[model samples]
Target: MSTVPVRTGARRVLDGLTRPAVAAVTVTVAIGLWQALTVLTGVPSILLPAPTEVAAALRGNRADIARHLAYTGYEIGLGWLTGVGVGIAFAGLMAASRRLRLAVYPLLVSIRIVPLVAIAPLLIVAFGATLYTRVLMAAILTFFPVTVATLDGLLSVPSSQLDLLRSVEASTWTQIRHVRLPNALPSIFAGVKIATPLAVEGVLLAEFLAASQGLGHAVLQAAANLDTPLLFAEVALIVGVGLALFGLVAGYERQRRWSDGTDGLGGFGTRGGGAPAPTPERALFGAVALAALGGSWVAGTVVVPNAAVFLPSPSAVAASLWETPDLFLTAAVGSLHKLAVGWALGALVGGTVGAVVAFAPRTRPVAGPFLVGARVTPTIVAAPLLLVWLGISFSAATVLIALATFFPIAVATASGLTTLPETHRSLLDSVDTPRRARLFVRLRYGVPTVLAGVKLSIVSGLSGVVIAEWFVANGGLGVLVNQGMRNLQPTLTYAAIACLFALGMVLFGGTTLLQRRLDW
Candidate 1:
């Protein structure tokens, strides 16, 4: 049994106001306020364009915007389709075999550490600034979340379901198809919905990085030309497309939820009902997979002509690190310090936002669209602008890291808090629980989801910190990376990249351990 105190009177009143008209009014009021603030403050249009200015710019460049938008949309569509297929397939394969999951999971973690935007230079060097490159980035970025969601979904089936299937002597594939897949599809669809915007984000980022065609190019040109109105317009266009896609996904999700034939038999998997038991051999396989990756890296350096210049030998990278161990260590320590502060701030703010979203229903209609927009906004491109505005300061960097981390934590927190069992919800509704008691109770139940969000935020926060360091040109690993790349020093570059990867792994491991401890 559970209880949550609801201040029933005002909440009931507010519920009546959460209609479509109210949302429209809220947004209108917000835009009006923005316009008034800009006009009264006399802020330079270059720094902060009024909404009307953005509208004018949009009107002026409608044709170009439409064409480039179409190009980007095509790339996004292709990438999202391929990524969805691959991610779902990969999750299925992993669910079907423990050994393969052990072998592949480490590689996935390692690959995830490398920010999608950061890999643009390497990709451009290897594959050129082509449409294929753009699509690849979109696909890769979209792949991860889908894979994770699908895997969790597949493992969520009830033990009773598994036992019954086994008693019936069901074939493994048949059991998987009939029971797990049906149960998982809803979860899978949720993943696909969340991933659609990410695909758009990836394509925009690829364009920004490689100066490829589409809205991304428009952003760069606007920024370079000091066309702030156009820049805002481009950003708006990008965000608009992402939101549209999100709306489509949401509609599909609604349809699926209503039509879900497996609703009675399927549920979101929190417990690993039929999952493989943990064993020492799983760790050994992960280690072997890592070793294989290293061997592949070494082989690439050996097999490819002129690869030595770009990829560098592992020995050479090792020697570079060996020679500059102190430098790397100090840089790592400094970066970690900044990352800690930013992550803490992000955790606080994002967690609060998520809690509000989950616990308070009346405020959702007003807040929901903004949250989704923020989720899809290509904040990677905003880093440089942040640097420009805030300058090379620690506070600025910390803020950037916070901005990066908060959204994931908030999303995760809401997910965790909202997933209370029906029994719990019913109990809460039937009793007048104290507010403090309710919050603490929910917090306890929400630990896993909140922790999951915190874990996701670390990678995002690291990316933010790295971008800050890259622009600040301070004594951090990102500085070393930038220096090495600009100078074409492969050994230095590889060494910095290696250190960054190591740092990511440490943070990831720490979070996993913490989550496990809390779960226990």
Candidate 2:
């Protein structure tokens, strides 16, 4: 009996090791298959280099790669710090003034909605192709998410706590320092984590579009020469930077006991306490916001010499809008179509996979690594490869959009499924419900969470489409932006950016409305 028990324990240990073993096997097989495909098909190295060739390129150009990496790192660091500082200041101002919050919050959100990639070229034109331009691009990318997150955290203080502070005669600044800031630390850290990879991506985009330094520039150069091995090597280095930054923020988050509950999608699970109801006050605030924006444009044009070269006057942008309505309309429609198609596809596939992983526990270990890779890999780094594989076409742009949209949806869907009440699952299990029925029920329960992810994905998908168009595709707002920058037409560039802003507002607003209607 004792010997039999010992044998059973040994078998159990082996069973516990099975999943890891299988995962290892799966990875090895996948890599082997990739190598086999390239070797057997006689594909040109320019189209898709072998992994070994990539490794060799990495070794051959290690010094150059490292130098470029340092440049990118410096740019990202400065820009991130600048953006975070500005975000903190803006958030503080909004928190202090109710009128300011009401008048300017929507405007800030609108700016946040615009894809930075689409406007990177405009930034180049405005700031010139200098380090400052790259840093500004990165800062622009970092600003919105950080500001929104910081604002969300600042406003999340409970009314009771605020009331207590008020009764004690605490000033606004005192309340912020003593209560709000501490309470918002977790959220601010969460936002920092969210902004980290984005900062890296922003630097890459700026380098690609403007700078002659950094990994992005190297990638572009390699692609131009059809040096696939070198291209892959540079991309891997870019991914490394992204992952390193992500890891640093994540490590800090863990140390602070902050979990990535919403997978870096801001305002997903947070309540909007400072949001004013639609009333005459809000109407007045809106009017004030428009006036402020108009005044700023007027001031820029009047106060600055040759302001149109950098900051095009609103009238100029409007005139461009009127003069080339079809051009703007067609580009807008094209980009929107690509975004819609790609976002839908990504959501469908990712949601399905997430559901499967949640229901089938046996598959989690096997699928986990690949999902993590997808989440961490910078899509910008892969843009050149995609251009090679799919060519300069809508298909390539759509693929990039899909990749950009997939990760958040999957993570959110999986989270939703896993967090379903045990009692609910037990009830379903008691009835011997079919697997499909169980999945549907879980999805229905998680609709709100899924919608939150959809909102984030809308922005991401838009950004991806713009990047793809800038690099590969011949149409869409990205192409228009490139054309504008090349021709030195600030009006055209600003008009395209304005259209992108409008597109973002529509998609984001529509999703939000749908979420409210569903009451999810």
Candidate 3:
């Protein structure tokens, strides 16, 4: 009369159905809570529309939503394809030549670190807010991740494999085709997955800035009119689009894993193995690359007719910096302060929640769905609604930054906590360690992963601050950018952008150095 086989079968079935079951239950509870709050609290529909109201709005405006979705979908599709193409090509080139990698990789990294919002206005000026501008913005956003991912994949082919190819006197192309490409496919798909949602974000940001007929535009209009239900509907649509794209990529990745029978791809892991010893060759090439960039900027401004109106010369931007040092300094301080505060708050909250979920296995099933939703929901779409709810203020911006910073930290913290060695946990349990002591030990062991998340949060916080300022706050680089764009002062706009880029580099570089020092 043994029930072991029946128990094992039950366990298998439970494990197989757990994820979807959790997700379904979470959604049901969330919708119920939303409706309950609105109905029981007597909150105005303008402030917090009930779930039913949102559903009605969706039903009433299906045609309009569909139209906008179509436009955004087109932009996302075009921009994503273009970005993947360019990224793969550039990654291949950099992989092919050591000198090129040394000379250009730093520049690419810098460009990628600079927030697109900082340059969106400049792009609008240069490209006149056309479909091209939107496409380019999306492409720019999608490019860096894909390039880095592909480059990592290309370089990750085992030395043994390379040697094998060399022994056969394989040409570089043959080596890549036979050895690198197949090995890199998983990583490339990983990049594609990362890039897909970002492509949606890029298009939404562009639409917010310039487009007349997209979900972004609708969001702005909804905010302006205080049409809460429509705003929710639009945001819902945007989230749906992002999730759809993300799901497609995730499905592909799952299929790939099943097909390849691998645990994970090498290239999908963290970049820059560790801090490298400084080299003269790297320094020299970096200098050369910077000089070339400056030279190109100067030439574009001086040689092209009225190019200074859009793409101002370095000297002109430098002059603007000199003339308005106070303005730039004030804005930089405001942005940095907000970013710091918001990032700290987000990390604190995310870490606590993640720790709790990790410690309480039962809680994870309930929390997982909400975490996924937060991670996928674009902060830009939430910004306008926040502005309306919270008003145009620093608090609003800080909230946005917190929202942007929270999910990554939470995910990282959970990952770090869950990955603790079983031996460590067992030893603590055997010793009957206090809960607090066990938690402390877990955090100490997880510092490296936590810090890695922090490093990422730095950039996320910076971007959040900029976008929040663009929509809500009166001070910061975002204000400088908006005014410069409206007033048609390209020099001021470019100068503000340059300051932001420098600030980002400093923060990002410092974080990287700290993470390295910690051997994270």
Candidate 4:
């Protein structure tokens, strides 16, 4: 009996290795094929470098990569810490006060939609492109997801638990420390890990805006010099770092799984962190927050010399908009078209694939890299290869947007799909529903989860649209933003930024309407 049990245990261990082995083999074969095709076709390395060429470039440019990486590493490390600290503290404050939550959450969500790079100029004006500016940009980029996730987790603690604490007459502080904080850990980790790659992209965006010593600057420099191999190598390093950070957080979450009972990454405690439907009270508070922000902007001009140049007055920005009303209108239309197309494509694929994957969750391990790559392949990294293949076309830009939006939707969809209500599951089983029917039959139940993903996607999609215009397209609000930045025209940049903000509000407002319509 003992011998038989040992043999079965050994077999189980071997079985567990199969998917990893296959994944390794698949990657090796893909690389082998890539090398062979490039070598046989004699394609120019500038267009599509072979793996060996990229590897050689990596080795050759070790010193340069190291130098740039040091700056980026510093930005990411400090930014991530700051983001976590602020995000959690702010969530604590909001949890402690309903009025604070009502005031701040809506304003923050609206601000989060601006392409993170666009803020670099404002920061540069205030802080002079120093380490503080770069770190702050990254922290701001990372703040929303963490705060939303933590806030939701804290607020959504089970009624049973709250009642139990109340029955014992536990102090609010004691209850929060023992119950809310502990249960919120899973969601907290979920947001932190998800934001890790965003932090990397954030630092890169800051580098793009104004920096000489970082991977983003290095990419632009290499592209300017037409050094394709080095560009690919640098991009690979970025993707690797993002994946490594994700793996680190995910591994820890797994180890702590025994104690985690609340929804993992899927539910995010509540639908991904949009503010609750507005009441008159919420509207007044949100308006107060916006008014305060606007007041601060006005106040800054009085303090800074030459504020008109660096921080254009609202009237100047508004005048800029009026001056080129037609230009902005045209650009907004084109940008919206591309945004819609890419979002639709990503949503379709993500929801479908997520559903299929929900039926076979064992696939997640092997599928992990591709899913992570979808997010980590920032616009800066994709610029060269996409331009090479698509030749500055709409398709390339759409793909870039899709890459930004797909991961969140897919993750959320898969999570939601797994949670079919018990009654619904049994009903379907009793009728022997087909797999295809089953996959979508309960989609209504997952609408909240999927809607959460869609909201997140809209934010990321806006960022993609900005970068797409910067690199691929010739006309868009993004082009205006880039041109304004390059020309040292703050009013023009701010005007373009205002258009982007308006565009974002439109998209988000539409989503809100759709959510209300569904009301699932």
Indicate which candidate wins on lDDT.
2
What lDDT tens digits, residue by residue, belong to model 1 across residues 1-520?
Answer: 1333355655665666756566677779889999999999999987888999999999999999898999998998999889999999998898888778778755665667655445545565667789998898889888976776677678778779989989989987887898888888777776776577669867876787666579888777777777888888887788788878877876787776733222111222223532355767767887899899889999999898778667888899999999989988998888888899989998899888888888886667877666766776655556545544575788877888888887888878877777667887679878977778777777887897777777677777877777767654366777777667657787786787788888988887787788888872
Against the true structure, what is every candidate's RMSD? 5.2, 3.5, 3.7, 4.4
Q: State the lDDT at 289 in candidate 4.
A: 92
Residues 452-515, candidate 3, lDDT per residue (tens digit)?
6776677677778888888877798878877888798888888888888899889878876776
Task: Point to the candidate with the largest TM-score.
Answer: 3
lDDT of 1: 0.75
- Looking at model 2, report the run of 10 residues with the lowest lDDT sum: 265-274
Looking at model 3, the pairs that clash are none
- TM-score (C-alpha) between model 1 and the true structure: 0.85
| Alpha-carbon local distance difference test for all models | 0.75, 0.81, 0.79, 0.77
Query: What's the true lDDT of residue 401 in model 1?
Result: 82
Question: What does the lDDT come to for candidate 2?
Answer: 0.81
Ranking by lDDT: 2, 3, 4, 1
| Candidate 1 root-mean-square deviation in Å | 5.2
Q: Number of clashes in every candidate structure? A: 1, 0, 0, 0
> In candidate 2, what are the lDDT values of residues 1-520, reduced to their tens digit?
6799999986686468765486676677777887899999999998888888999999999999999989988998899889888977888888888888888777777666778777777677776888988888778777777777887788888789989999989999999988888778777876776777778888888888777778989999988888899999898787777777777777877787867476665543235745755678877897899998899888988898767676778888899999889999999999888888888888988898888887777667778767756766767877899877887887887788888999888877877777668999899999999989887888777877777778778878888888888877778887787788788787888898889989988888888888888654
TM-score for every candidate vs. truth?
Answer: 0.85, 0.90, 0.91, 0.87
lDDT of 1 at 487: 78
Q: Give lDDT tens digits, candidate 4, residues 56-159.
A: 99999899899988778888889988998899889888877777888887776667666666676667765777788889988987787788777876776778
